[model samples]
Target chain A: MTRPNLQVALDHSDLPSAIKDVTNVGDIVDIIEVGTILILQAGDQAVKCIRAMYPDKKIVADTKCADAGGTVAENVQKAGADWTTVICCATIPTMKAAAEKIEEVQVELYGDWTYEQAQLWLDAGISQVIYHQSRDALFAGETWGEKDLTKVQKLIDMGFRVSVTGGLDVETLKLFKGMPVYTFITGRGITAAENPAQAATDFLAEIKRIWGE
Target chain B: MTRPNLQVALDHSDLPSAIKDVTNVGDIVDIIEVGTILILQAGDQAVKCIRAMYPDKKIVADTKCADAGGTVAENVQKAGADWTTVICCATIPTMKAAAEKIEEVQVELYGDWTYEQAQLWLDAGISQVIYHQSRDALFAGETWGEKDLTKVQKLIDMGFRVSVTGGLDVETLKLFKGMPVYTFITGRGITAAENPAQAATDFLAEIKRIWGE
Candidate 1:
């Protein structure tokens, strides 16, 4: 099994904060996700800035695109995204257009699918999936529980290149040490740290230690 | 009967094109929508720029936020969106958080619910809905047919502040006359024309002629 990469999520509402933190962790991070909050707040200028700064790094424009699939997919990829995320509920037409656009651009598309919406990937003919842990749920008295781990295993068993995210920290990451997630996404986990570089380096080390990458 | 407002959607892939087109029609447009393509390609900078230019006009961030609802709602509104849209499939937790944030900021939330998902807005305590016409369907030889119009009437009867969008041109706008649409969103309908100002003015005039605004 191929080990997953550490994708640092820059969810900062401000462009400078995200750029400052991304510069700190860029050496250790494998994928840089310009998160939905940043995308909605900063726009493609963020994509341009990040793309210019890291020409070789893989970047994900997490648009959570629910509509206007073709136009968004074509343009975001043109703006220099290696991957773009579509929401779980996109229309079949949107999904089909997105898949075609991704292929044409030599990029990839992942759907943010919930348990009930798992079938959407099959319908969309896209295999990559992000099994998100809701931050609202986390703040509303729920912890990342056993079901989430099992869900990850289930998605892997079902032949998905699964990605997991939700306010992940070092302490919480121990739970998925040997799991077959294709990507481990961290946001405030590294960005909020005093020394983001040290924090990201530690995360990389931990991933390597756990998965023997 | 409340008259519908002319909302010019800036769906351009480049920020400069959107800015220029919006500037041409700004005086007549009641709402300036940072369309999905603009939002994904330009990020929140699009919203900030338009907001700075038209401090009095209503701006829809059109994040189409499907997850991390609270953070997106609070920040986009703070970034100067008069309204933020959430995908119909967002989790209850996301909806709850978004509703609270929009209310706290004294803005609005519109849910893009499909036919079956119409009740989600009521469940989320949001009154606005968008009966989106999928472009994929249009390309696939599926026109925005009668079922879509009926669905609009259904939503209005159900007491929703309904908005309709998707490749709306003047010919198509004539079809929705006397309907209870709260807002009519036009992107290429105005921006794609050789004379975008004349196109937008025509749309505004037609709206008044049809709805007696």
Candidate 2:
């Protein structure tokens, strides 16, 4: 099986801090996510500025569109994002609209969703889905468990390039030891670390350790 | 019943055109929406710029938060938006997070939602909701019909300040003649018109004609 990729979710509320994290660890990570908070606070220019700095790296504009998917997709594509996201609850037409505009569109799994919905997304030509443990859920004291693993496994089995996110840390990497995760997305776990560079490196090292060279 | 507020939705892809529409009709319209498209393309500054231009006008940042509600609400609130939107599909916790941060939060009604769900949002302390005839659904030949009116009426009965939107035009306002809509949101109906100022005046005239001066 191919190794999973390490993606740093740059969820900084400001541009300079996001840029600092990217400057510190952009080379070691497989993808740089200009996260939703950054885009909301700093604007689409966050994607443009990061794109300018890392011409060759994959960048995600986590716009998490719920509607006007086509317009949102086109906007991020122009800003140079390689991938963008739509909420899983967005309409099938919304998903189709987004998939038509961008090279890759991931359905961000939030709240409650069904495999039936994932099938429709795949049918609509979207192949990537992010299984999230949302911030509020984390704040409410939820944790990654067998139930999440079962859903992720089911999606992978159903032909999705599944990426997992939400407060993931290096220790959490050990949970999916044998699984073929497409990508592992970490935000504060890496960006808010005392040494972001080392944090990023540690995440990559753990991935390599678990999934092998 | 009180007259419904006329809100102009600036769903333009760029800032200049959005600014132009605001400049032309900012005085006539009751609210200015920094539409999801504008926020995605131009960033949250769209809210700040409009707030600066018309300090007295109510500004709605249509952020449509699916998660990270607190962060998204805080971002738009700081950018000078008087209100922000979270999708109807968002979790109750997500809705609560957003409501806690902003003075006013409107749940943007999208695909397949229930009064049961609306109750959850209302219970979470969000009193405003935008009932949308989504653009994709419109492109697929959907229209504002009895079912939509019924749902809007029910939400109003349940204590929500119901705001209706999507592809709304001057003539369409005639349909809700006697309905106690808290607000009527129009986008292309005004902003994309040959004369936005005249269009705005026409909308106000229609609102007055329907619900009286």
Candidate 3:
């Protein structure tokens, strides 16, 4: 199994703050996410600026686009995003429209999804799936848990590059052991830390230790 | 029954173009929507610019916020939006956060929602529920049809203000014959017309004719 890559989610409201935080940890992170909040707050300028600043890093614009797929896809691609996300709940026609628009960029579908819905997205030719742990469940004393692992493994078996996110931390990362996850995304755990770079390094080290990278 | 108010959805990518279009029909439109595309393209600047240009107009920022509702609500409200939209698919925690942050602004929710979901939003203190008509459905030769009316009335009886949209035109306005729709939103029909002001006036005229306002 391939070792999971680290994606640091930038959920800040301003570009300068995001740049400052991410720049400090850019080397350790394999992917940089313009989180849904950051995208809505700063718009395409945030994506363009980040792309300009770090030409080598893989950037995903988490538009969480549920409709008007063609327009959203076209706009984000023009702004220099390498990947854009669409929700699993979006109509197949909308998803298909988005896919057609971003033939040059990677399209990821969120797997905070039902088994039936996941099958629908994969059938629609979406290349990736994002397994989101519910924030409510996390706050209600749930760990990554066995059910999540089973679901992740099921998705991986279905030929999708799976991404795991939601309340991920050093402790929770262990729960993903033996899963064929393409990437592990963490937002507040790293970006909200006093020393973002060190936090990123720690996350990277944990992933390496777990996966023997 | 309250006569449906005509709303013009300005979904352009640039603020200047949007302002020019809205200025032409500002006198006729009852509500002006800073559409999701515009909000994503220009950020809060789009909302602020429109508010500055037309102080009396009721502006709805179609942020379609799926998460981080507090940040979106606060930012859009500060930008002078009278209302902001959140996706119904967003977590309940996100909805609660948005409601808490809304001081005097209305929160609108959209998606393939049921009456139960509308009830949940109302209980969460959301002000309005939007029943979006999908463009792809229209493209696939489906009219607004009968199902929408039943859904609209069901939501209205539940004390929720229902906004109906999806390529609405002069003929489509007739479909809501006896429906208690609070708002009738038209985008390309008005904004993309040869004479936007006249098109908007005609749309409102048709609504008045149908609703006997």
Q: Best DockQ goes to which candidate?
A: 2
Q: Report the error of model 3 at residue B182, Å.
A: 0.9
Query: Could you tell which candidate, 1 or 2, scores higher by DockQ?
Result: 2
Q: Candidates 1 and 3: which is better by TM-score? A: 3
* Candidate 2, pairs of clashing residues: none
For model 1, state the Cα shift of residue A208 in Å.
Answer: 2.9
DockQ for model 3 equals: 0.43
Candidate 1: give the clashing pairs. A41-B44, A42-B44, A43-B42, A43-B43, A43-B44, A44-B42, A44-B43
Stretches of candidate 1 off by over 4 Å are A103-120, A123-125, B103-117
Cα lDDT tens digits, model 2, B141-162, are 8998998898888999999999
Return the candidate ranking by DockQ, descending.
2, 1, 3
Candidate 3 structure quality by residue, lDDT tens digits, B1-213: 779888899989777899889899977889899987887778778888889988998888887776667787878888888888777676666667766665433334333445666677778777577777666556656667677778778888888888888878898888788777889988989999999989998998899998877
Docking class of 2: medium
Candidate 1 docks at the CAPRI level of acceptable
lDDT, candidates in the order shown: 0.76, 0.89, 0.78
The full ranking of all candidates by lDDT, starting with the best, is 2, 3, 1
Error of 2 at B189 (Å): 0.6
Candidate 1 versus truth, CA RMSD in Å, comes to 3.5
Q: Write the per-residue lDDT of candidate 3 for residues A83-179, one digit (tens) a residue.
A: 8887665666777777877743333432234667667777888868777764544554656778778878998998888888889988788888877
Worst 10 residues of 1 chain B by lDDT: B103-112
